[model samples]
Target chain A: MDILESIKVALEGIWVNKLRSALTMLGIIIGVAAVIAVVTIGQGGRAAILSSLESMGTNLFVVYPSSRNATTPITRQDLITLEDVEAIKNIVPTVKAVAPTSYLSIMTQVGRQKEKTTIICTGQDYKSIRNLELVEGRYFTSEENNSRRRVAVINEELAKTYFSGESALGKQVYLMNTPFIVIGVVKNDPSNALGFGGDPPKEATIPFHTGETLFRNLRIQIEGQTYSKEEVQETIDQIVKLLHKRHRNEGKYRGYSLDQEVATANKILGIIALIIGSIAGISLLVGGIGVMNIMLVSVTERTREIGIRMALGARRRDILVQFLIEAVVICLVGGTIGTILGTGGALAVALIAKWPPLITPGTIFIAFFFSASIGIFFGIYPANKAAKLDPIEALRYE
Target chain B: MIKISNLTKVYRTGAISVTALKGINLEVAKGSMVAIMGPSGSGKSTMMNILGCLDRATSGSYIIDGVDVSTLQEKELAKIRNHKIGFVFQTFNLLPRLTALKNVELPMIYAGIPSKERRERALKALDKVGLADRIHHRPNELSGGQRQRVAIARALVNNPAIILADEPTGNLDTRSGEEIMDIFQQLNQEEGVTIIIVTHEREIADHTRRIVHFRDGVIIKDEEVLTPISARTTLAALPPAGEV
Candidate 1:
């Protein structure tokens, strides 16, 4: 029989038992759906990492004071200071700006609203280096930072939470009972999950001098952005050489950035996708078994019909083709439906998570063929069984 | 035309063997109407199976038309069966889901006939069976006699050398049975299509020109009927039934 003719017959058989065929195809549908959802999520995760890095700063890196031994995680001597930031600026031509940062956690009271928040102490260049966008008011000036002014710049979350929609500019909020006026409110950062660089800190920003005046024992963390990504190596080398000369502690400082964080995160996300995909693969295998079970039942149910065809001069190969085609048709139908539904679900999830879902044509094809091959792999045994039955006995079957 | 020599069929179950057809020899002339009659398990059905190429003989040669189909490979036997023989089973055996035209086109499909020609030929065959208006009806929608007629149309669609029927009228009423027999006789005498029927009823066997009687697994009597009964003339003498 012609392959098309056999396909026609197979379609008729599937149509005759609509509910059974649909139930049999359910496994493939869910299996393929999971695959598509995972791939789309993986693509979204990679994109999120890239965009998060870009939003934090342009061509940026962070310098950490590395501990030389296992016992001393952070010693008194292993701390980046303001001197290191100044030295790197004078040493490297590509150096844009360096913000020597220090963290201070304290309780703040604004009228009836009182909460604990961290305070960031950095230079006037912190505005440019960290790309801090102003939603209201303005950042502290060089004179205010030099003279140690008691002024502050709060983020959107801190301003909204403490101020309760009240105007934050010129308002006084006490940190550890020391009243400091709110100078500005910065825009909310959406990529806070990446940690320091992209996080919208619930804190105030004061000048380098005022921070020194407030805290006696200071441990500074210096971060800088460069002219471009290509100048990263030169900037790091110059900073390393400068720190070595200033403190005579060679290899004491380690370089990091949102870029490195992204690379690590992407590697982790790739593995995550694979793990989830493998779990989904198991579901697909189970679905294939369902197809096989249903096909075996169908073969047995149609044994007498097979005998009639055989007696009408159908070859064994013809019977094999018929059943195999039936199996494949079922899988393809389920695959097509699953692909559409999966893509839709991926888009919905991406929208909810505020991430862009990327679905390549190649991945779609891979998923489609994967399900089709599953049908073939599971279908062969039953088709072979149907083909091998003795026509005389089959005809005699009641 | 068929020629059989020392035909034998032994079925094995584990270590035990039972001979279904025991060393029987028979010959059937082309365009002749013949019947093989016996009780159940008398080997008449076994002989029909071998003749239809549904089973292979154990130690014998059976030639159909000009080819020695006994020595043919399984695939070759299938091809010969497709081209040289047609089958009609007792239960009507019409696929209940398919319309009469589609059922008739089945054998031609196996024979690789094109769709347009298959449709044309299937329609012609259904018309020959006097179900031209009911070509689109599924088997369940048709009566037992009409179902048998559909099966006959399916058999005739391929235009094979011989039509082999196993109790074709066994499931029908006497009038419907007579109608089925009438059609077979018309195909034999008018179209000169060789017909072989396997039946146990002596009256049904008497309608054919030749009857081969089987006792146990061997043929006991093979004789030509001097005057064969005419199913068409008998039906004509009775009251006219509704249009089939």
Candidate 2:
């Protein structure tokens, strides 16, 4: 029989039992929709995390001091020094910029408002090194750091809290009861690298020289040895060499790179996304099984019809094509509707939750083709059964 | 022409076998009207199935028009069914979802006739069966007699070498049954189309020029009717068209 005629017959069969056909297609629809939505949501999440990590400076490295002694603390000098930063930049050609930093939490007063916030003290080029942005004012100049001027930069949150209804630039804020002029209001950084929780830090910044002069005496112990200003580089070198030289400490420092950390986090997120997507794909498998079940029922119901066609000279291939087309039509229709619903669902969630949900063309193609294949795969047994039916037996069927 | 010798059909149901046809021998001339009469389970229906290429015999040497049907493949058998034989069932078997015209056009579609020609030939067939005005009427809308007439038109549409009917009037009342038999007789006598019908009624058998009696899957009697009644006269004796 002609293919068009077979299609017509299949369509007529579907039309004759509209409710059954629709119910059969529902499984495929939900399956495709779930697959599409889950994959899109996963993709959106990956993009969100990657962006957050990237905003922390893709090439920046952070090192924390470690000590075996319970009484020892990782002082700013013990962890890093100006000389080590210079040496790393010069000796390691790949190292771009390094700025040592120290922070302390102190209560500060601005006008009548008082808040406790962490204040960071770093070198002149700290802003450039950490990729900080200034929204309202400018960073402190090198001359200000050399002169030990009491100048500070406030983060956007701190600026909003202390300088509400007024510009924070050139304003005076009290840090540990010491008056300091705000040279700049820093832009809110996208990454929350230093925050204890997932939130960005609320803080202030000051020149490292000014911090050193105000704080007076400082000491850092490394491996039972006391390290002062001149010995800071020696302490850092001993720590690095000791950690790398000992076989017992090899695991602690093995492949310990910032890029590796970022890559590991990305890999973890990728695995989570895949797991969620596969769980959703189970619905598609169930839908395909539903198609197969409904097709079997349809063949049983249409036995007499099959017999009539066979009696009218329909070949086995014709019977096969007719039933197979019916199944494919159901799945194709379901896939199309599922894609639309899935995209709409993703968009609605993104809008409500305010998270970026990406729906790519590749996802659409995968969903469509996957559902079509499901139809064909599930349709085989029923089609074969119909094709193999004996015309005499079918005709005599009640 | 048709020939069958030592044709046997055994149907297996699990471990048991039922012989539907046993060593049947028969011959039919090119353009003759013949009817086979038998009781239920006498295997006349099985003989009809084998003759129409709807079933295969377990052992046989059956030839139609020159081709050995027993040696034909399933596809070749389907071709024979498509272009060499037309079937009229007692229940009409008109597709309920299709119109009378489409029901008649079904065979032509299987024959790969294009839509234009299929439509033309279907309409002409319906016209021959005196259902031109009811071409678009679905089976449920037509009376039993009209439905059976539509089946006749479908049988004629493919211009097959032989027309096979299995108890064509078994489901109809006497009047409608007589009307159907008259149409069959007209096709055989006027168009010179070879016809073979299986029926249990002697009156129906009398309408044809020859009768073959089947008993226990075997032919017991074969006789010729010297005085062949004119079917057109009987058809004319009925009420005019559209009066049922």
Candidate 3:
């Protein structure tokens, strides 16, 4: 019989035993669904991280103090201060902006509400360096940062929590019992940071010099933005060397861009996704075995039918093709359903996790073809068994 | 036309042997109707199986329409079965899932006929068997007589060289049996189709023009009926269908 006729016959057989066929296909459905969802979610996460990294600016670099040996402790002289920031701004022409930041996690109070918030003390250049967006009011000026003004810029989360109904601008937010006027409300950029479970903590920004009196033994984080990506490593080298020259310590400072870290993380993520996706594929193998088992049962059940077809002049190849087509139809149908469900599941997860769902056509194509191949691989034994039956004995079968 | 010379079939199971057909010689002319009748273990079924190309003979030169089928491989045997022979089983053997029309189209499907032509020829064959109105009914939905007629349509749709019926009316009532015989006789007389019937019932065998009796795997008697009983006359004499 022709392929079309064989497919029709297969479909008819499946239709007659709809419940049995569906039960047999359950394994494949789960297998394909898991593979698709896991792979898609993994890709989506990687894409989100990469996009966030790009949003942070590829030319941006961070320089922090690092003790080369465990035996040597970092002294106050090695800390990044206004002088080092000045030297980088004046000496490094490649550097666009140099912003020094200090982080202090402390309790803050606004009206009757009290919450723990990370206060980031930095210069006005931090707005451009970190690519932060101010939704309301303006950032504090350089004069305010240099004169130790107690003005602060709060993230959207803090503004929403403490000042939900009213504007946060010009509000008195007390940090460690010291009052700082809210100068601006910056939009919360989740991509700015990674690996925060559930929701990130509330954050507020204050002037750089204003944190000196409040913080002791402060380890400052220096952020620099360059005009282009090509000058990032050279500019980092220049700043690190400048710090080393002033501190009289060769390896007292470390500098790197986010691009290198992102690449390494991407490689690791890809490997991890592959490993997890392959683990999911083991179920597909089991599903293939289930298909084979059902096909075997089907062949035995239809022995009489095979005999009748043979008597009607069906070649052995025709019988084989008929059963093989039935097996493939089951798997392909299951695979199509699984693909849709998996993509939908991945989208649901992406919605909750706040990331885009990334599913490629190639992944779907491979999945479909893989399922069909499973059918063929698992179908051969049963089909061959049916094809080789003695027409006499088969006709005699009850 | 078929010619069998020294046809023999041996069955071996774990050193035990049983010869189903032993040195049997038979000849059947084209467009002739014949019946092979015997008791159980008389080898009539074995002869029918060999003649239908459903089984290979152990030792014989069985020729059908100038082709030496005894030495043919399974593939060539299948081709001959598809093109030159049709079979009607005692149980009807129609695919339960198929309607009468689709069942009739089965042989033609194996013959690689196109769908449109297969449908047209299947309709014609069903009409010839007087089952055109019941073509949409499945086998279970059909009466015993109607189901037999559908089987006949399926056997005839491919227009093979010979139509083989093994106990064609074994499961039917007297009236349905006679009606089935009437269609066979009509087809044989009008279209000159070669037909072979395997039946143990003497009454059924009387409707054919020739009878071959088998005993102990051998043909004991082969004779031509001087005045063959016409199934049409028998069916007409019986009570009208659905009254008995």
Candidate 4:
């Protein structure tokens, strides 16, 4: 029979028993919907994580002091110096900028507003080393850093807390009861990349020398160690060698690179994304099985129809094509509906919950192609069954 | 023309073998109306099925219009059924979902006729059966006589070499059955289409010009009926072989 007529007949068969056909399609619908929803969510999560990492500045490297003994804590002596930062830049061609940051937990009072936030002390190059957007005023100059002038750049949250609708730049804020002038107000960093999760921590930055003098007392049992800016490379080399020599008593500190740790963080995020995507892929498999099950039932129900077509001059290939077309139609319909629903769900979540839910064209293509292949893969047995039916016996069937 | 010699059909049901047609020998001339009359289990339906190329004989030499049909493959046999024979079952076998017109057009669709031409031919066949106005009526909407008439139109739509009816009137009333027989007689006389009816009723057999009696898978009698003058004139006016 002509393909159009066969399609008409198949459609009529489906329409004749609307409830059964709809119930059968439900399996496909659920399967497609599950696949779309899971994939969309997974993709959104991956984007969120990558974006969060990106906000930390792609060019910056984080260094942490390692110890062989878990109980041994890294102290102020283990802190990276400006000289070490310059040495890394000079020695490593790929190192564009280096900012050694030290954090102190302190109570800061802006007028009557008081909040506890992390105050990071770093060099004049810290602003350039990180992709920190300044919303007001300007970063502290190198001259101010050399003079050990007390100046700070407050984060958006801290600025709002201290200034309360007023611009915080050029205003005095007290850190640990020590007065400091705010030179700049940094823009709010994205809570997380891709907008999948909660907001990140609040922080502020100040000139390195100012931070050390205000937060540290010279009366402590430690010798004052000062290195010139030009000797930063030698200072970093000496620090590495000294640490290695001192830790020669232990094996854990060997072969450790701060840059390697940052790179490993990115790698971990990538692996997490892959694992999430793979977990979502399990739904596609279930959808394929659903197609197979429904197709098997359809073939059994249409046995006599297959027999009649064969007896009426249809070839085995014709029967195969007919049944395969029906299977594909079911999946294509389900896939299209699922794609729409998935995209809508993503958009809704993004809009209503203020979460970033990305729906990329690539994701749609993947979902569609995967669903179509599922149809073909599951349709084979049913098509073969229809094609291989004995015409005489089928005709004799009640 | 058709020829069958030493036809045997043995069906295996598990370990036991049942002979449906045993050494049957029969010949049917072109343009002749014939009936195969017998009681149930006399193998008349089996012979009809074999004649229509819907089944294969275990052993036989059966030729139709110079082609040996008994040795053809399943696909080739389907081709024969599509182009050389049309079947009318007692059940009507009208797909319940399709209209009368579509039912008649089905065979031509398998023959790969284009839609426009298939519709035209199907309408003409329905017109011949006097159900042209009911083309869009589904089988359930149609009366028993109208449904059987639609089947007749379907059987005639392909213009095959032979029309094979297996108890065509078995489901119809006496009046509807007579009406169907009249249409068959008209097709045989005016269209010069060869007709074969498998029936157990003598009244149904009496309408045909020839009868082939089967008993227990064998032909017991073959006899010719005397045709009326008008029927002879109608047959004479029909187009010759290959013209219709």
Candidate 5:
């Protein structure tokens, strides 16, 4: 018989046993649904992270001393210092901004409020590079930093606790027995700073030279930016070369860009998506087995029908094709329904989470093909059984 | 035309063996109407199945037209059945899900006839069986006589050379049975198609030109009737249908 005839018969068979066919398809529905939802949602999360990293600035890069593998342990003298930062700024023409970090950990007091916090000391360029806006006074000048003036900038946590709704600018706060005047307050943004970047720090910022002069022992963190994101690599190479020259060719520094971090983050997320997709695929295997089970039962139940068709001059292959087509129709229908449900669920979740769910056509195709293969692979045994039956015996079957 | 020589069939079930048809030789001429009469387990139905190519013989040479069908493969045998043989069962073996027209079109479909020609031929066959108005009726919606007529239409659609019917009137009332017999007689006479009927009723067998009687896997008698009963005449004398 023709393929169209077999398909018609198969469809009719499914329609006759609609409830049973639907029940048999449940496993496939769940399997395809899970794969669709997980992959789309995972893609959404990856996209969200990439955009956030993009907003933070793709031009951003970092360098740290390659301390662990060095032939000799790095000392304070071997670490990045203020002289190295100044030399890099002067030598690397591609460099747009440079900030040398030096910190003094101490307890600070403003009126009756006292808190133990580190005082971050850096240059005026730190404000522009950090993309921070001042809510109160201005940052310290280059001359004030050179003169080692005892001035500071504070975050909102300090302002809320110490000032108690009063203006904190121009107030005196003592750190490590030294009195410092508050100059600027950075605006607090809690929404965008989520996960891993936990609660904002309750700290103050002082001039680099002022903190360096006050504390004999200070840990330094050097941050810099390039003219553009594309110039990051050139600027980094120049920084390492300048640092090597200043530190007598120790070559103990390392640099990274935020773009690289984004790539690594996406790679990790992709692996996680693959792992979850595989876990969901296990249910598909079980679902295929269910199809096989139902197909076998259907074959046994339709023995007499098989006999009739055979007597009507149907070949073994015709009977086989009919049964196989029936199984495939069930799975394909189930897969279609599952795809709709999964896409709807992903969109619903994305709406709630305020992120776009990314579903590619490739993902849908893979899922549909997988469901079809599941049907064919599992349907073969039962179809073969039906095809091999003796027509005389089948006819005699009550 | 059919020729059978030493035709035998043995069925095996694990350690048990049952011989359904003993050694037999028979010849049937083209365009002849014959009836096989026998009681239960008399091998008449077995012979009919072998004639219909539904089962293979253990040892024999059965030739149809010019081909040696006993040596043919399962696929070749199915093709032969599709092209040349038609069957009408006592229960009127019409597919329950199909309309009468679709049922008639079934064998042609298996024969690979195009859908348009199949439809045209099926309609013609149904009209020949006087069921043109009932083409859309399903088997369950048909009376026993009408169901049998649909089966006959199905059998005739492929324009098969031989029609094999097993107890064709076993499930019908007297008038319906007589009506069906008349239709078979009309088909054999007008179409010149060879007809083989398997039945236990001597009254039904008497209508055919030849009667072959079987007993316990063997034919006990094979004889020709000098004057065959004309069922159409008997049907004409009976009261109109649907009467108690």
Candidate 6:
């Protein structure tokens, strides 16, 4: 029989037992759906993170004191100080801007609104080093950092959460009970998830000297930016060398570019996605087994029909092709439905998570190929069994 | 035409074996109607299966239309069956999901006929069996007599050398049986089709031109009827029944 003819026959068979066919296809549906959903969500998350990392800074690297092993510990003397920052600015021609910053999670309050929030204590150049945009007011000036003025710049998220409808500029907000006036409000950065968890954090920034006075024993980190992307590594090397020389600790400082960190993060995310996807693939294998089981039952149920076809001069190959086509049709239909459902599921997740879903045509093609392979792999035994039946015995079957 | 010499069939069950047909010799001419009648387990069905190329003989030579079917491989036998033989079952084994027209087209499909020609020939065959109006009806929707007629249409759609009917009228009422016998006789006398019917009923065998009686895996009697009964006349004389 022609392939089209066999397909027609298979469709008729499926249509005749609609509920059974649906139940049989449910396994494949769920298997493919899970696989597609995982892949799409993983890709979307990776894209979101990478894009946010890109927006964080350009040609940026962080230089900090390394905690060398216990055999050669890093002392307080090795910490990156304001003098080291000045030395890098003066000595490194590749360096464009540098900011000495400290991150502290503390309780802050504006009138009745009180919450625990992150405080970014940095120099005036923090804005240029981090590419921070100001939605309202302005960043603290060099005068504020030099004189240890009690002033703060709040992010848009903190503005919305703490101040409500009131503008946060020139308002008084307390950090660890030390009152500081809000000098500016910077735009909320979605890429803040790198420091915090996935949720963007509410942040208030203060002058570096003011932070040193307010909180003692601060571990300072020097964030620097290069003139261009190509100069990032060289610039970081110069900055680290300057710090080592100033601190008199030869191997006590490490500098890494933001791009390198992001690459490592991407690798880790890829491994995680692969692990989850393979776990989902186990369901597809189980689904294939389900197809095989149903096909065997169908072959047994249609023994007399097989006999009739054989008596009508159907070759064994024809019989085999018929059943194989039936199985493949079932899986392909299930796979198509799964692609639709999985895409829908990924979109729903992306909607809730505020990320764009990344579903490529290659993902869909791989899904199709896998489902077809499962059908063929599982379909062979039963179809071959049907083909090998003795026509006389099958005809006599009740 | 078919020629059989020293044909035998042995069925094995584990280590035990039962001989079904022993040294049977038979000949059937083209365009002739014949009936093989026997009691249950008398090997008539075995002989029919062998003749239809559904089974191979153990130690015999059976030639159909100049081809030695007994020596043919599975694929070759299937091809010969597709081109040269057709079958009708006792239970009217039409695929339940298909319409009568699709059922008729089954053999032609295996014969690799194109769709348009397959449909055209299937319609013509259904019309020949007086089931043109019911071609769209599934097997369950047709009466026993109409179902048998659909089977006959399927048998003749491929234009095979011979039509094998295994108790074709066994499941039908007497009137329906007469109607089926009428179609068979018409196809035989009018179309010059070779037909063989396997039945135990003496009355059904009397309608054919020749009858071969089997007893204990051997043909005991082979005789030609001087005057064969006419199924059309028999059907016409019966009381009128519901539309089928």
Error of 2 at A359 (Å): 5.0
Model 2: per-residue lDDT, tens digit, A1-398? 77888788788878888998899888988988888887887677667767666665555444445554324444443444455445544554334444557777778897678888887777666687556788888999889987989999989989888877689988899877789999898876665632323556678989877877766542211111111223433444444654334323322321123344568777987898889889889998999999999999889988988888888888888889989989988998899998998888887766774558798899999988998898899998899999999999888877
- Can you give the lDDT of residue A169 in candidate 6? 80
Which DockQ values do the candidates obtain, in the order shown?
Answer: 0.77, 0.66, 0.69, 0.43, 0.52, 0.77
Which residue pairs in model 4 clash with each other? Answer: A48-A193, A48-A194, A51-A193, A52-A193, A83-A232, A87-A233
Q: Model 3, A110-163: lDDT tens per residue?
A: 878999999898889998888989989999999998789999999998999999
**2 or 3: which has the higher TM-score?**
3
Ten contiguous residues minimizing lDDT sum, candidate 6 chain A: A190-199
lDDT for each residue of candidate 4 in B97-152, tens digit (9 for 90 to 100): 78999889888878889889999999999999999899999999998889999988
Candidate 2 regions exceeding 4 Å error are A48-57, A66-78, A81-83, A86-95, A102-121, A140-152, A157-183, A192-262, A344-360, B228-232, B235-244
Residue B92 Cα positional deviation in candidate 3, in Å, after optimal superposition: 0.7
Q: Which of the CAPRI classes, incorrect, acceptable, medium or high, describes model 3? A: medium
Candidate 3's displacement at residue B90, Å, is 0.7
Q: Could you give candidate 1's per-residue lDDT for residues B46-100 as a string of tens digits?
A: 8998999998999899999889988989899889888888898899887888899
Sort all candidates by lDDT, best to worst.
Answer: 6, 3, 1, 5, 2, 4
lDDT tens digits by residue: candidate 1, A1-398: 88889999999999999999999999899988888888887787668766876787646777777765234465566577776777777877888888888878987888767878888888888888778799999999989988999999998889987887988999998876778999999875544655533435687888878989888877787778888877776687677667757776666777776567667877887887899889978888888999999999999999999988888889999999899988988988988888888888888988887887888898789888988898899999999999998898888878
Each model's total of backbone clashes:
0, 0, 0, 6, 0, 0
TM-score of each: 0.94, 0.84, 0.90, 0.81, 0.83, 0.94
User: B1-244, model 2: which lDDT tens digit per residue?
Assistant: 8999999999899999999888999999988999999999999988999999998899988999888999899988888998889989998888888899988988888899999999999999999888999999999999999999999999899998899998999998767888888888878878999999999988888889999999888889999977766655766786766555
Model 5 reproduces what portion of true contacts? 0.46
| TM-score of chain A as modeled in candidate 1 | 0.92
Higher-ranked by DockQ: 3 or 5: 3
Residue A296 local lDDT, model 2:
98
Clashing pairs in 5: none
Regions of candidate 4 where Cα sits further than 4 Å from its true position = A1-57, A67-97, A104-116, A137-151, A161-166, A169-183, A190-196, A213-280, A343-366, B223-244
* Model 5 regions more than 4 Å off: A65-67, A71-79, A92-94, A101-122, A130-218, A228-253, B15-17, B233-244
- The digit string of per-residue lDDT tens for model 5 on B216-238 reads 88889999988888988888888
Q: lDDT per prediction?
A: 0.86, 0.80, 0.90, 0.73, 0.84, 0.90
